[model samples]
Target: MNRIGIPLRVGLVLVSLIWLVPYAWMVVTSVKTLPEIVAAPTAPLPAGLELGAYREVFESMPVARYFWNTTLVALGIAALQIALAVPAGYALAKLEFKGRALAFGLVLATLLVPAQVRFVPVFTLLADVGLTNTLSALILPFGVSALGTFLVRQALLSLPDSILEAARIDGASELRIVYSILPPLLVPTLVSLFLFSFVFHWNDYFWPLVMTTDDSVRTLPLGVALLREQGTGVRWHIVMAGNVLLSAPVLALFALAQKQLLNAVAASTS
Candidate 1:
């Protein structure tokens, strides 16, 4: 080990705790009695755990519907984004076409444009087609993801040109080369992008807030917001419970795909 290893390990441990403590607190708060929470908000340990808050969350809201909405939109965004980004990225990375650099530059330029900046134009366009308060409104605007495209492009760029040339020499069409040859190699990067898009759109509050008007189409974040508003006073326990329920999917996704994400990122950058 290096001389700095001990200190570096200590620093990382502290950083991890600093990041995780809040989430741990949220889980604790979710189980605590309201009175216990009020008495000592900063207490790391709950005096006793109860399922009351979680029970109330389910009783008061359509938790299943919220989950369905969130899952539908998240999956829709991820699938459509991959469908579009894979081809766009492949073209930009491999195929010779006029203005390809300019096109790729424009795609990168989108990363700088905040979602807030695009909301009005996108909303108006969707509204013109009468799609507001619908899942389409949520999924359509995200059909192409700039960051996803960039990741896929970088992943493709990292592939050995000789392998692609060999495939071409085997009389494979470009589409065949892309569809058949590239996918196995691109799996890690695709998984990373899928998880990134899913988590992002799942937790997204602002866009859903703007697009949806009713519980029928609202996601968990919006449903959680509604829970807070429906109560005359805030219930921290219930709020935290709702948050825990809301965050479960994202946590599971990360836990399952973390290694793939890390490996793909490392390979892309290397």
Candidate 2:
């Protein structure tokens, strides 16, 4: 056991370091002087702390505006997904309505369909409605999350029927039961869903790239991508700085929600 454990731990540490290499390089490169970056592009450590790249990133673009736009879109998508998922999940899991199986089947079927396949139709629809290049275009297409519904339904399945029965006996309405009773018990699962939706939408690039033509509704990822085009040539330092900023919020969110995310996975799998 000791011998096996040591090798396993060592292998895990090696894998972790490999995964962190790019992120570590991004951070290191972001703080390096332009001269140093130009001279030694692949150096793991910066010789001196320089924030000019960060300053340049801010000055060259509307990073704050991009950040705000991305935040709004991500929050909107996550909120809509959860709000719709809870009821849809509950009904699919607990209710005995007609065509429940077919409804759930439809939900599952959507998961098999790649999102890329729907982009043209969705983009055309948004274009027809003049919602293209709007934040609504980003959020609206993602509002109905089949994955969120599936996770919530699975979580609800693991819950006992007695809870709902008791709520009904107390004369609680279905709406009250869904909003009041189930949510509290579903905290871990909901948090997991919120984080999932939030992170995906926050980091999303292709959808925004397809939808937006200019900076008016451009997201952080798009803004970061634009960094390479700012200067006379590809400014690696400035681009890395933008990437660090792009990744910070997601890293913080995961750090905060790691426990709840684990619990949600455990609960669903159990």
Q: After TM-score superposition, what is the CA distance of residue 31 in candidate 2 from its true location, in Å? A: 1.4
> In model 1, which residue pairs have backbone atoms overlapping below 3 Å?
none
Please list the residue runs of candidate 1 whose C-alpha ends up more than 4 Å from where it truly belongs after superposition.
1-14, 39-44, 160-162, 165-171, 263-270
Q: What is candidate 2's local distance difference test score?
A: 0.89
Which number leads on lDDT? 2
Off by over 4 Å in 2: 2-12, 262-270
TM-score of each: 0.86, 0.91
lDDT (Cα, tens digit) per residue for candidate 2, span 87-142: 99999999998999999999989988776999999999989989998999999888
Q: By summed lDDT, which 10 consecutive residues of candidate 1 come out lowest?
A: 261-270
lDDT of model 2 at position 163: 88
Q: Write the per-residue lDDT of candidate 1 for residues 1-270, one digit (tens) a residue.
A: 557787798999999999999899889999998898889988888988798999999999999998999999999999999888888888988889899999999999998989899999989998999999999999998899888888889888878789989999999998887777887888878888887788889999999999888879989989987777776788899999999998877888778878865664565454
Note each model's CA RMSD in angstroms: 2.8, 2.2
CA shift of 184, model 1, Å: 1.4
